[model samples]
Target chain A: GAGVSQSPSNKVTEKGKDVELRCDPISGHTALYWYRQSLGQGLEFLIYFQGNSAPDKSGLPSDRFSAERTGGSVSTLTIQRTQQEDSAVYLCASSRDMSSGANVLTFGAGSRLTVL
Target chain B: AQSVTQPDIHITVSEGASLELRCNYSYGATPYLFWYVQSPGQGLQLLLKYFSGDTLVQGIKGFEAEFKRSQSSFNLRKPSVHWSDAAEYFCAAWRSNTGKLIFGQGTTLQVKP
Candidate 1:
């Protein structure tokens, strides 16, 4: 894809139900990031992946949230036992490379998750 | 801990009026500053960034921001704002050690025609 792409533009899941959001990063990009934007709040970093290395998961809100990147191309964010507070816009972004200075991120349209 | 502060939660300006949005950051080391705009139902779009070089950095849409190290401020400005410029603006600062960004709550801009 020419730019970062995310699937399921919108999803509504009942509380306690599990959900999965997918992201397809730009081709040849080596760095991918996930963020969450709550209502009237700034974007919060969720995870970051640099190539095939272990991802930076420090920002995951809790153990219920996890993500995986396969083949260094597509990634999936999984939320187990979703809560109403989990509702937010999930954003995915990709950069050419992490080590490169002046790396501007290209972002996807984002997926709006609503936990009822 | 690194943090970004956008004092104004909402700002209103008439069309063709000059605009300034205040942003302050606290970081132990030199900061990587950025401003991004988000229209309703849209993802964030980077307006500009400041890493080094001249204090004043120019960005798209005739917007510019000046990095003031002394005051820990990076204020965004535009000579004249159009109706299309109405959007939510966010200021962010990245931690050099971890490359993580701490963003401000955001400022909603309203352009009156």
Candidate 2:
């Protein structure tokens, strides 16, 4: 794709329900990251996937939040038993490479999830 | 605690006037700085970045920012504001030790015609 792409731009779900957000990064980007932006708050890092190395899940808020990248091109973020606090804009970003020590990223429009 | 701060939550400026948005970061050593803009219901777009070299950095859409080491600030500036430039701006910093970018609360710019 020409840029980072995301699915389900707007999602409304009842509490305790599960939801999945998908992200398709740029054609050759080797690094993918997930971020959460709440109303009136700064973006919070959620997770990162770099090439075939193990994912860095240090930032996930809880065990219910998990993500997977299959075939190293597309990624999916899943939330189990969603809560109101999970209502936020989930942003996906991809970088050409992080080994150069620069985090130059291109982002998707984001999935706006509203858990009621 | 290390943090990023944007003092002004919202700012209003008349169209064609100069604009400045302030950002500050607290850290023992200087870190990579970046500015991004987010229009209504859109994804964030990178404006510019400062790592090393000259203090003044030029960005897209006629935007520029200066990094001040002493004041721990990276303020975004535009010589002339446009109505279309009205959007939410973010300031972020990254350090290898932290391994993640820390962002400020954001400043919402309102351009009045």
Top model number, TM-score:
1
Candidate 2 chain B worst ten-residue window by lDDT:
B94-103
Give residue A28's error in model 2 in angstroms.
Answer: 1.6
Q: Can you give the TM-score per candidate against the true fold? A: 0.96, 0.94
lDDT of 2 by residue, A13-110 (tens): 99999999999999999888899999988799898888745346888999999999988889999999999999999999998877766778889999
B105 in model 1: Cα distance from truth in Å? 1.3
Give the runs in model 1 whose Cα sits over 4 Å from its true position: none
* Residue B26 miss distance in model 1 (angstroms): 0.9
Off by over 4 Å in 2: none
> Interface RMSDs of all predictions?
1.5, 1.3
Tell me the deviation in Å of residue A116 in model 2: 2.2
lDDT over C-alpha atoms for residue A111 of model 2: 99
TM-score of 1: 0.96
Writing each residue's lDDT as its tens digit, candidate 1 over A12-80 gives 999999999999999999888899999988889998888865447899999999998999989999999
- State which candidate has the highest lDDT: 2
